[model samples]
Target: GYNSHSVLSILMQTYMDSSTVLAPVPSFWGLVNSAWNLCAIGKRQSPIDIETTHMIFDPHLTPLRLNTGGRKMYGTMYNTGKHVSLRPDKTHLVNISGGPLGYSYRLEEVRLHFGSEDALGSEHLLNGQGFPGEVRCKT
Candidate 1:
């Protein structure tokens, strides 16, 4: 059985392959495939429009704690075509908790995205601006 991540990866790959021939626009992503319906209709998608005026700070939020067993961790890095990914070894358990999170989470993967120019790269926008690159962590 395939996990949700695997299924999503397959769907994304299929979309990428088909888009080369179809040239479907971003708005038509969901229309091109049922599995990617969220790409068109999802409210909390990537490249989010972050407005600084709407920002609110929570003073009660605690700092995040990373438990690395007080030792070094080893991981393998891979170029997934879309981005660079790092998957840590299972022997070294890295767990994170606190920081507004209700439960502790393990670091599953780390993804890095960058572009040739500074205008386009980040996954999300900051006050309607784009950064040169971004690092995403999957937990």
Candidate 2:
């Protein structure tokens, strides 16, 4: 188990290193254009604009359940230039269910994004207003 952990750590670090070196540098406008194009082209893109007026509130929606309480969650932290992220152990996957979700979901990782200013750095917007930071949990 120790050997596997060590191997995973090393492999992840290597992958990160290679990815950072190989990733292309894009300007703000270029990034925006690419995202817009992807949103227009892709059928299943995320981070879509959520219009509060069209949002339907269901009283019967159950609260989401996370199975991380009362147990230790082992993970490793890494920096990905723009944000700090945590890579959780695969063996100890987080179980999530409830809400509008039809089935259980397993949390893979988590990322934190922050900006030096209050007007920038959020990955998602709330009615077109940006926040200083946000936390994203991947499942």
Q: State how far residue 107 of model 1 sits from its true place (Å).
A: 0.7
Q: Report lDDT per candidate.
A: 0.61, 0.55
Top model number, TM-score = 1
**Model 1 spans with C-alpha error above 4 angstroms:** 1-44
Q: Give the top-scoring candidate (lDDT).
A: 1
How good is model 2 by TM-score?
0.63
Residues 31-113, candidate 1: write the lDDT tens digits.
86675686688886655655657655669899777788998978999998878988889898776667744456677777787
Q: Write the per-residue lDDT of candidate 2 for residues 45-122, one digit (tens) a residue.
A: 344444456555769889877787567788889999998999878766676567754455566667787778664656
**Ten consecutive residues with minimal summed lDDT in candidate 1?**
5-14
User: lDDT value for candidate 1?
Assistant: 0.61
